[model samples]
Target: MENCELLEKCVFFNDKMGNMPSTASVIKMRYCREDSSGCARYLVCKALGRENVPADLFPNQEDRARQLIASAR
Candidate 1:
């Protein structure tokens, strides 16, 4: 899959698991972008995919990602 797709999937999985890594965590890991968009999530997901993490392992990843993004105040 493309990097963007992988990142999205990773964010979905992570958020679903209730372990949403903070923006600081992402920044410390150098995954966050200056752009205030979903780009950070995408980057993190792509990184996870590079490590061979399977998105299918989390059945509700997409839904969870959507919910997390929506619920973010």
Candidate 2:
């Protein structure tokens, strides 16, 4: 995932749960700062030597995606 995508998936990256009720619309940031200073993903990315994850990292991407589907959950 790119920096944008990874940042969006952060557990703390709540976008007001969609929008403000009064407006019924989502107000999004026009641009991303693209800094990893305040997120756990920061350490992971630092260790990986990239601003973006490369189809890896459980918190960024689903861990299930790393393996074949299991017969039982």
Candidate 3:
């Protein structure tokens, strides 16, 4: 399988998502969604080219988004 740099750097990327590494289930990384209660990829997709990943964009990763925003500057 191809490596997904996005999932590699994403805070929501959990090794246990599918009982193994990040790609245990999905054949492709893009099809993987964070199982967290927040980012809600069902409602909104991940954002890009920002100081942070954007809380509103990755709602399932709100706390990580906040940290990313603060650490950016």
Candidate 4:
């Protein structure tokens, strides 16, 4: 599947699990930040780009910040 589609699926999975739909949380839970730079919004945006998804789906700083906070919990 395309990256955006994959991302959407990943988020859906997170939602289903009652977890926050943020990459950082998933990364921390599954892969931890030490192994990587953690899950950054830019990476998600890039993945969306790879899937030809609209950038507007995830505006930018605002969305990222919101996701980050949600994931921090």
Candidate 5:
């Protein structure tokens, strides 16, 4: 699958995951590179906007992402 369009600007990698290269790479492979639809940050960004996606939000936090989307609606 194609990489996520928001990969370059994703705070998860640029900031949160900056200190953990190995872990970040693994997550990137699973979410940013392989598939982004399941990424919580991506979900919020798509449903609302990049601004609405919390800086602390991680790719795997799908449940929280759903709640955020719901609250916004």
Candidate 6:
């Protein structure tokens, strides 16, 4: 599949994970490239808008993402 449209702009990858390239690479492959719809950041961005997506949110934190989405509605 194509990479996430947010790949270049994602704060998690561009800033938060910049110190850990190897780990970031693996995560990017899984969530950003393979399946962006499953990414927590992507979910929040879709549900609440990019401005509401926390900078600290991680791709694996789907539960938290869901909570944020729910709270918004």
Ranking of all predicted structures according to TM-score, beginning with the best and ending with the worst: 6, 5, 3, 1, 2, 4
How many clashing residue pairs are found in candidate 3? 4
Residue 25, model 2: Cα distance from true site in angstroms: 18
> Which residue segments of model 3 deviate by more than 4 Å?
1-16, 20-59
Model-by-model lDDT, in order?
Answer: 0.39, 0.35, 0.40, 0.38, 0.91, 0.92
For residue 73, give model 1's deviation from the true position in Å: 4.4
Q: Whose lDDT is greatest here?
A: 6
List the candidates' TM-scores in order.
Answer: 0.23, 0.23, 0.26, 0.19, 0.90, 0.91
Instruction: Tell me the deviation in Å of residue 39 in model 4.
Output: 20
Residue 9 in model 1: lDDT = 34
Residue 49 lDDT, candidate 3, scale 0-100: 49
- lDDT by residue (1-73, candidate 5, tens digit) is 9889998988886778778889888988999999899999999999999999998888999999999999989
lDDT of 2: 0.35
Q: Which of candidates 1 and 6 is the stronger one according to lDDT?
A: 6
Candidate number that wins on lDDT, 5 or 6? 6
Candidate with better lDDT, 1 vs 2: 1
In candidate 1 the C-alpha lDDT for residue 39 amounts to 44
Worst lDDT run of 10 residues, candidate 6, spans 11-20
Encode model 6's per-residue lDDT on 31-65: one tens digit a residue: 98899998999999999999999988999899999
Ranking by lDDT: 6, 5, 3, 1, 4, 2
